[model samples]
Target: RTRMGQNQTSIKKEKLDDLGNKTHFTQKQLKELNKQFRKESPSGTISQDEFNEAMNLMGVVDPFLQNLVFKVFDKSKTGTITFSDFVNGLSIMTKGTQEEKLKFAFEMYDLDESGYISKEEMTKILESFYKLIGPSDDNPLATFSGKKYDAPQQLVDEIFEQMDVSGDGKISLAEYQEGAIKNPDIIQGLKLFSES
Candidate 1:
């Protein structure tokens, strides 16, 4: 029985080491993250509804943004997030480089994985954003800034006019990278994921 227990311990350690190799987190960090994930999802997988509840607890209350994030994290398209998926996606959002994060951000907008962001795609994302941060009496821009806010369509047109350098009517990945690097505000505006 002691030998069997030792074998089980070694197997668990091996699994953690494997995940450590795949993610940016250390073994200890992975363990902690897994503990948190399991605490939230005891079945070792999180359904979309559970994910939405967790995001709401994290203060991410925008249903549209929450849905987009869940779609991005559910890479396997199984409509559920496993521990591995959660860790890998969290690693990218928390520890990935600027370009890597931008790539993930681009994926959120690309929608069809077509390697480019069409105007319609951008419009959908921005419309969701506008729903969250749209003009309101509490919005400073609507109050003190005294600046006219562009509608979602106008915003998408302005973004394409600036980022679609190839004039191909689509914003390619390269154009997105360049535009994001040049305008930090663009990255801020595309804040579906928390960079912190």
Candidate 2:
């Protein structure tokens, strides 16, 4: 059993090399990445608890986004993220093909995994950004009349108009691709490619 596990890790290392070549990360970089991953995930996979720790290390305060990131890396739909999947998932956002990056972003925003990023989810994500930047009076999440908001309806409307091509309240994967293509800043700001 131990030998089988070792072989799997070795096979994963070979795949990681292929991934690194495509992403321009040399063997040394891949080695360092694996080292760091092992520091946090010595078993070659990271469970939800370990993922939370990693998120905390990244100074990620929002639980929602943290979980979304975990989901992205757990491509096998398993509860934990293996080292190979972790490296591959990181590449998807940082230097993978355009389609891979867009697919990742789509999953990132689709908090519910409902196959679409609903207007409510969009509003929540936008509100989270405002919170991170220190909300001002104009920010949707700011208390209005000494009370929290039920929803940021206006912000959702504006976002829908910009990206919801089918007049649906949610953004589908197709709509997300078109919107990202239309707004280069979305790609650049999100670091969807190494060039950005």
Candidate 3:
């Protein structure tokens, strides 16, 4: 049994090494990268130097509507973003008939159909968003601007709590619509689509 255990551990270690090679970043390297990122964007506000630094850090890549995304997520005047902020940004970016989109989002987030989105409901929504946006094994987002990824779970919870203004544990269609309109990306997308 001891030998078998050792063999299993070795196999797992080998697999981890293989993944590291494929991803081209060791755990320490990843930590350093994240540290560097935080050092640069600690307050979330983009300085010109930071902007240029990010360009260099992330490498040349296609713009994935990042400026619009940053504008939407930088809520609370905080320099750093949480997961909730990211999803709220996505909610705003989603396009459709305003009423329809709001209704759908509210329904999806309102797990209990209590006509409001609770923290639990919002977590699920954020998870869904991560699944939608996270780097897939087959294809990944361009490595520009550090690749816009899904929000962290804790951040998602915070965002849900903040958005539920009435404390009713749910967000109504009106609230959702209002939030959506506040998002510049969604508004721009809607406007461009309308014009086209």
Candidate 4:
């Protein structure tokens, strides 16, 4: 039993070293996060249902957005996210640079992973966002010109207009990065998790 415990300690040390190098966190921080993750998911990985529960605890009640966030964390597409992936994603959302945050946001928006965001994809994400936060009376798109258009679609169109600088039908990473940097609303949308 002592030998097993020693081996586990070594394994954890190795993981902490590896994850520390890859993430912008100290060894202590990683250890705490690993402990928290283990408490939430004793199996050492988080299933979709477990993820949904965690998101609910964090006040992200929209299942679509929760699933989207889950997919982003499950980088391997293995139907579950390991602690390593979880911490990596958390690092990006919490401590990563602006460019890194924007890239992560771009990945979230690029639902199909086609390296671009289509109007439909953006609209769907916007719809999910509205569902998560509910309709806002102060929404800029609430009643433009005294008309109640589909706010999600209007937001998508506005975003596409700002982001599709090449006049292309889809938004590439470069365009997304550039557009997000220029637009505070885009940046806010990208930082939804952190800001929320």
lDDT: which candidate is best? Answer: 4
TM-score of 1: 0.82
Q: Model 4 clash tally?
A: 0
- Over 52-126, each residue of candidate 3 has an lDDT whose tens digit, in order, gives 345345441223223323433445546545433433333343434565445544554565657666666666644
lDDT per model vs. reference: 0.79, 0.72, 0.47, 0.82
RMSD of each candidate relative to the true structure? 3.8, 5.9, 16.9, 3.2
Q: 20-113, model 1: which lDDT tens digit per residue?
A: 9988999989999989988878999999999999888876778877877887889899999998889878888888767777888888888888
By descending lDDT, how would the candidates be arranged?
A: 4, 1, 2, 3
- The better-scoring model by TM-score among 1 and 4 is 4
Task: State in Å the error of residue 36, model 1.
Answer: 1.9
Using all chains and alpha carbons, the TM-scores for the candidates as numbered come to 0.82, 0.74, 0.35, 0.86
Residue range with the least summed lDDT across 10 consecutive positions in model 1 = 139-148
lDDT (Cα, tens digit) per residue for candidate 2, span 71-125: 8889898899987678777777666777778888788779889999998787777
Better of 3 and 4 by TM-score: 4
- On the 0 to 100 scale, the lDDT of residue 86 in model 4 is 96
Show where candidate 1 strays beyond 4 Å.
1-11, 136-148, 190-192
Better of 2 and 4 by lDDT: 4
